[model samples]
Target: MSLRHAVLAALLSGEYSGYQLTKAFDVGVANFWYARPQQLYLELSKLESDGLISGREVVQQTRPNKRLFMVTDAGLAELARFAASVSKPSFIRDDLLVKVQAVDHVDVAPVIAQLDQRAAAAAAKVEILDKILRRFRGDLDEETYLRHGSPIGPYLTCLRGRLFEQEHHDWSVRAAALLRDRATRNGDPPPVSGQSR
Candidate 1:
């Protein structure tokens, strides 16, 4: 999907400065869509030129002046159009996956470490997201919120992130166990006269 639609979707919540949008994208949208501050700013300008969004300069008391951005009708329309379109599924392109795919020819130490690191990062993100979700609960399950109130995109993506993170943790623990098992056996005698390969 285009960054144009992503920016519009972010603005759907409310007006946000480029900095705020960048952080939001990092924490909230990093799972499915990724964007940097420069990319968001460039897209903001492009959106403005394309009549999809509008920006206003906001003067701050003790901070640098920032441009606050909001979605225009055109932006909302574009997002709606995107919402109606069919989306193809995407899969992981992780370097750690590359190592796992070639495990027969590669040492497991570095890949194990990388998976461990990724699992830790995913856990940290889950904690952060849980906090955000708790703030939104208000006597309703997050699932109800997704079904009834507010835009479902963030909630759905957040669910995806939470599920994927859990999978990461589970996969990492399994992989680590296998690696540890191999490590433990590496220095042992050859399984009673090489019974099997």
Candidate 2:
């Protein structure tokens, strides 16, 4: 999906300034789509120019004025059109997978290190996503929230992110352990922690 559609979807939550949008993307949208602050700003400008979003300047006494943006009617219509269109299938395109594919030929030390690092990173993301999911549900229990929550899109997406990260962590840890065991059986030296080579 285009960044435009993502931005429009984000704006559906409410009006947000550029800074707020960046934070929202970081926490909410990063799971499925990643866009830098500069890229978001650029997309916001483009959306505004296209009449898909509208922006207004808000004056702040303690700080410089900022522009708050919201999706326009056109934007909602565009999103509807996008939703009706058939989506292309998603595919994995990770470099780490490529390395793992060549693990038989390449040195196992670096691959094991990378897998360990990936496991740690994925675990951290799982924690963050758990907190976010909790916050999204508030006092409502998960079943209750899923049954009767307003605006469940973000919550659902965050749930997907959590699942993805949890699986990633599990797989990474498993792969690393298996490789370490194989290396030991073959009398290869243990990988030095945090060493790239």
Candidate 3:
């Protein structure tokens, strides 16, 4: 999906400054769509120019003035159109996966190290996403929240992100352990201490 649509969808909650939008994208939107801060700023300008969003300057007494933005009527229509369109299937294109694919033919030490790193990163993300999901649900239990929550889209997406990260962490740990076991059984020398490769 285009960053255009992502930005517009983000503004659906309410007005946000460029900085606020970037923060929102970093936390809430990063799961499904990844955009650099510069790219987000550029897309905001383009959307404003196209009349898909409107911006107003807000003055602060102790800080520089900032422009807050909200999606316009045209932006909603564009989002609706995008929602109605058929989505292309998603595919994985990971360098780590490529390395894993060739692990049997090459040195497995580096691949195992990378997998361990990935497992740690994914575990961290799972923890973060779990906290976010808790915040989204508030005092309501998961079952109750699914039946009665407002603004469920973001919560649903966050749930998907948590699940993906959890699975990734589990798989990475499993793959690393399996490789280590195989290396040991084959009498390959252990990876040197503090050696990532």
* Candidate number of the best lDDT: 2
**Candidate with more favorable, higher TM-score: 1 or 3:** 3
| Model 1 misplacement above 4 A | 143-151, 188-197
Worst 10 residues of 1 by lDDT: 188-197
Better of 1 and 2 by TM-score: 2
**Mind giving the per-residue lDDT tens digits that candidate 3 earns over 82-197?**
99999999988899999999998999998888888888888888888989999989999998999999779988988888888888888888888889888988999765322211
Poorly placed runs, candidate 2 (over 4 Å)? 192-197
TM-score of 1: 0.87
TM-score of 3: 0.94
Rank the candidate models, highest lDDT first.
Answer: 2, 3, 1
Model-by-model lDDT, in order?
Answer: 0.77, 0.91, 0.90
Question: Could you tell me the lDDT of residue 109 within candidate 3?
Answer: 92
Cand. 1 Cα-lDDT = 0.77
